[model samples]
Target: MASVRFNLRLVAQSHWRSVHRWQPKRWLWGRARCCMSSLVGRRVMLTRPASQAQGMAANLAALQAVPILLPVIEIAPLADTSELDNALFALAAYDWLILTSVNGVGAVWDRLAELKVPGLPPALKVAAIGPKTAHGLEQRGIQPDFVPSEYVAEAIYPGLGNVNGKQILLARADIARPALLRLIEQGGGRAVDIAAYRTLPAQADPTGLAELRRGVDVIAFTSPSTVHNFVRLCNGEQLRFPDLPGKPVFAVIGPITAQALADYGVKPDLVAVEYTAEGLVAALLNYFESQPLRNSL
Candidate 1:
């Protein structure tokens, strides 16, 4: 993961190389009409869940890119959040509270609001993995004490620093990975993990599938599940991301998302430095900026 920083420029260039090898402009859209912005007239495929997709869509539109809504995942509340409620009810027992995603922050905060929990426990500090997560916590009037420099699990435990014997509460998605929990425990901290949300594959509409087949300029993936469901939606039981027409380029949010595509034998054309919404958009524009002719917008 550390080496990723040094290889980013190489990866960005490598993606351009791949794009150049393809029938020129098939992916870049030859001779696009400029709209006084870098992304004017570009077709950007947004593959995040619908609720999350709106924000990204507006961002793209701001840059004059036409956003194509192609949601491949859905977020739902857990059938039962009793466990989470119980943990929140006893916040005093914990020394720290951990949140891994914006969704988790939202879920836990929403529940606390329902229970009318106070701002936050004074002694129980909080940690969030990403900026969005921390920002979500802030929106609820609870400031997170720490947020990992990097978004992945590998960065969390270390970021917490000297958590020996500390009680930590980890509120996350129902299908959240256990790696973070194990790491905290290994560091001599007692961690309690609760599920605040569930991410399920959303049914893809046939119209959306048909548009995908017709090809768009770029397909943006924000998470691993989006990549998986994208393949499932396009390939069905055959279970493979189709050889999408129109020479679409894959722009991922970060390394985790890039890795997800790699698992399915797909190489992302570009990966963001920061694992946040702003970072994703900036990275995509940077990719286009690398090519002078493509920069005319």
Candidate 2:
């Protein structure tokens, strides 16, 4: 895992320099009229879940690019909430409440509301993995006690301070990695991971699949599940990702997603250093600007 992360860092450093060199009139957000010309009229396929793809689609459209929505993964509340409900009712017993994604934040809050729990206990510290998750908590009038410098789950450990003899409750996806929980346990923290939600494969959208068959300029992935589900959907339709000319450029929001693509023998064309929708768009603009020929395709 260390070696994998090290390789990802190297790739990030290489891509960061390229993304840093470009300066669009309004890189991430502003009037579409002021956006860079490189992405104008280009078709970018967004592969996030339905609920989460809107922001990225809006961002792409605002940049004057054609956004094709193709939801690959669906986020749903788990049917069996008894386990999570029990965990939330005993929230005060835990020293920390760790949320790993915006979905997790939503699930935890929904359960809390259903259970009639007003809010988190005053003494319990809260940790959010990224700005987006932290912002979700903030929307509910809760301020996180800690957010790591890096957006990844592995980066949240140092901010947690001494966890010896501490009890931590992690509200995360059913398919979440065990890295964070293992780290906490190794530090003598009693970490209980509760499934806040389930990630399921989204039924393929006919329009989106047709657009993909015709070809797209770029395809963006935000998570491993998206990458996996995309390939699954394509395979069901007898389509395969190829390396021919005019093939869609594969762009990912983070190294983990990039690694997911790599696992399927697909190397990402760009990886966002910031690991957010805005960052992904910025990287796309920068990539197209750098490779002017891609703009024509």
Candidate 3:
């Protein structure tokens, strides 16, 4: 009996080490630590670009949640950067440059760096929709003159203060909404919008369906493109949303993404009030922490 108890203890220790390999702080002083933010057994789906999904997955893992990578869309460089080139070469013409996404910042800066473009004209000011966008510009040694309190274009366009007779350069994805340009023109500003990158649905296998067939807790959509591409893939694969096991909660980044989901006649379970990565994660945590779940799929 004594030897059997000792063997069981050894088995428990080995199992604990294996389970906590990625989570080293699970035990302290022979007591199991409880983290308020842990999502330990939850598997959440992420529908962002493939290249951008890893960072989010790392973040999820930090919260003790499993990140299900479901990259529905990807950003591609525009074949014709001629228009973008013209805008870059004539940078002095624009009074304000607005960058809405990190992809835009990368594409624009890549070309500008290739030409060894000098400092932006003192007369020109730069605007980024959010911190992430600003960080992208900062990496290229440029700082935004302004970032709106809210990350949406609705807030950005109106917050520009006075734009009477000012020329604005809006560099963004090929399929970006034109409302910002319309807003600029409505504010008495002439705008030159250029496509720095093109967004297209990525060709990927619809993985994790078998897991979903069992159940999933949440599916998060980060963009309108992601919403569209995901639904498209589901339809093509004959994977109906209603068939998703457990009636998993659908989390969307912001109002725009939520509206996209609504277009497909599906309502989101949660919409982030703040549109950034941190905001989405917080929303997810808020949801599961307040709700109970079954022990397993």
Which candidate achieves the best lDDT against the true structure? 2
TM-score of each: 0.81, 0.88, 0.85
lDDT by residue for model 3 (16-127), tens: 3355222322322112134546466678888787678776677677777778877778889888788998889998888899999999999988888777886566567788
Tens digit of per-residue lDDT, candidate 1, span 180-275: 888888889898888889988988766666667666778999888888888878777343364676667789988888988999888899998767
Cα lDDT, model 2, residue 51: 75
Residue 68 miss distance in model 1 (angstroms): 0.7
Clash pairs, model 3 backbone: none
Per-model CA lDDT versus the true structure: 0.74, 0.82, 0.76
- Residue 192 of candidate 1: its Cα lDDT? 86
Instruction: Give a tens-digit lDDT track for model 2, residues 1-297.
Output: 323321223454334334532333245665456645578888999988877888778878777888999898999999999999999999989999999999999999999999999778777878887667877876886767777757788788898899999999999999998999999999999999999999999998999888887788899999998998988887788886654235889999998899999998988999987778878888888888876544443
Which of candidates 1 and 3 reaches a greater TM-score? 3
Q: In lDDT terms, how accurate is model 1? A: 0.74
